[model samples]
Target: MTSDAGPILVTGTAGFIGFHTAVKLLDRGLEVIGVDNVNDYYDPNLKEARLARLGERQGHQFHRIDIADGAALNAVFTQSRPRRVIHLAAQAGVRYSLVNPHAYVQANLVGFANILECCRHHGVEHLVYASTSSVYGANTNMPFSVRQNADHPLTLYAASKRANELMAHSYSHLFGLPTTGLRFFTVYGPWGRPDMMMYIFTKAILDGREIELFNHGEMLRDFTYVDDIVEGVVRSCDVVATPDPQWRSDVPTPGTSKAPYRLYNIGNNKAEPLMRVVELLEQRLGRKAKTIMKPMQMGDVPATCADVDDLTRQTGFQPATPLEVGVARFVDWYRSYHQVA
Candidate 1:
């Protein structure tokens, strides 16, 4: 039953994007080997529910393994022998990194090293991993482009993800590994994390609680829907990156490389104001939100937008989910999931 794609390994299968990507892969008649530690970063119940959904699929076999545990991770690679890898596991949360710096080191750094080694030893065809928009750091430019520098990372979380990109590039350069890194914008949808603004604001409005507005509702985010993100992930796996003969050190670009490494931003391409998102949620839920405006917290940028021209040109796809439609769907799922009125 092995197709040309082969069995793909997806880390963090219990997480939002990982689970959605795994399901999409399974639907395409490909085998998936899923791994997740299932820690209590947010709510374990939601993670469990996501896992359960994946369990319903036939071509999936899940392992409760942390990527930071190199021995356990290597065992999975030896056993599954996945032909391609979509590495999504990491300690997530930008603000939380302020208090928990070590978590990023263990998960993002150590886990990433383990993944690269596994892919290297296992002879994987293509490796795709998740990068974040936060890597843009202090760049105030509209529609953050991969061609721009991302050396300034405000938080440990962003720094760790940036390091992952560097590490992948090194592996690609040294070992001839075909790798693609996706810088995902603010991804939100049904089964979203409780810590994300979309879920937090929706819950606060439904409960008549005050939701914190950072930067006094002036901040902007290109909130890419989960399904759109999943599409990007799958397409990236299909389009294996190749060495760019046009790459030259005389005039360099961050998007392509001399080696088989590529980076693309996966985002909505629309920078919607934070306040607009809140208003849309209010309209969808038929409830008013009690607001508490506050200045921007540490390790956070003012806005982020993705320049997806390269992504469309390469994969013939770009995230096009409308904000209102996506928000309405999220509200519906939130109401049904939480049994809200």
Candidate 2:
């Protein structure tokens, strides 16, 4: 982004990653105008808690708006006239998409359209949006790389995010909008979404309830820490994407195009077995969790490990936190937040 660009506009500020990224930016004393509807996709109280944290920070301005409503979103752009946008707001969840497909359509698809147009017409310097590792669906390749084909998505959620990349590419091609899309692996830490594995497993273990161990302990994930993810995000925002001069349509790489568009994976670069995550939690909380063995559900992958070579190569950054340490920090926060002994 240009040095003279206006205050950063970040959507989904009430959400997990959004909240963390916003706080980090604010801590740096950067002007940020956050947008979120605060819809109850999960527990509204959790969303409220995240927002409360952001509220405590200076240079953090907020708007209660939904990106799905084009008029409201457009109004925000007209008012804030932000030059750099971190478009993180979207219907996020793999299994939930199967149940409520329309939410994905409205938030992920339609909402992204509004953001693209805003960036195009508003003379936005750069647009960085969230993509997902789930886009690497059905590809059995260990340590998924950005250079690989991701045409087959097991869930609508992943499909929508992949579409966001395509849509952003078109805008970059047409309007010269520098766009960077980061495909994040299983992100976790304090202030994580309750629906994700980290929070669910931790909560169940504490409650003495049976945690659903999907794929019968065979699943693998590159569970990234939230702080590390935020570091990558902040760096990506500062460095606007530029067109790859070497990119050739004759044998094009999907990760980059002739336009100012780029894709990189932000992950731990380490895939841990699902059982290992449980084991670490058991050690942290000092409690045994009864496991309900279950087959892999639809829209789910057997394993995911991100090859962050390009992420490091292009951005000069990496996720350095170890899973055991991150999980321990989370357990500490969880116990404090919920007042668990």
RMSD (CA, Å), candidate 2 to true, equals 1.2
lDDT of each: 0.92, 0.92
- How close is every model to the real structure, measured as TM-score? 0.98, 0.98
For residues 67-106, write the lDDT of model 2, one tens digit per residue.
9999898898999989799988999999999999999999
Give model 2's TM-score versus the native structure: 0.98
Per-residue lDDT value at 227 in model 1: 96
Per-residue lDDT for 176-211 in model 1, tens only?
999999999999998899999899899888888999
Distance (Å) between predicted and true CA of 14, model 1?
0.2
Show the colliding residue pairs in model 2. Answer: none
lDDT of 1 at 328: 96
TM-score of 1: 0.98
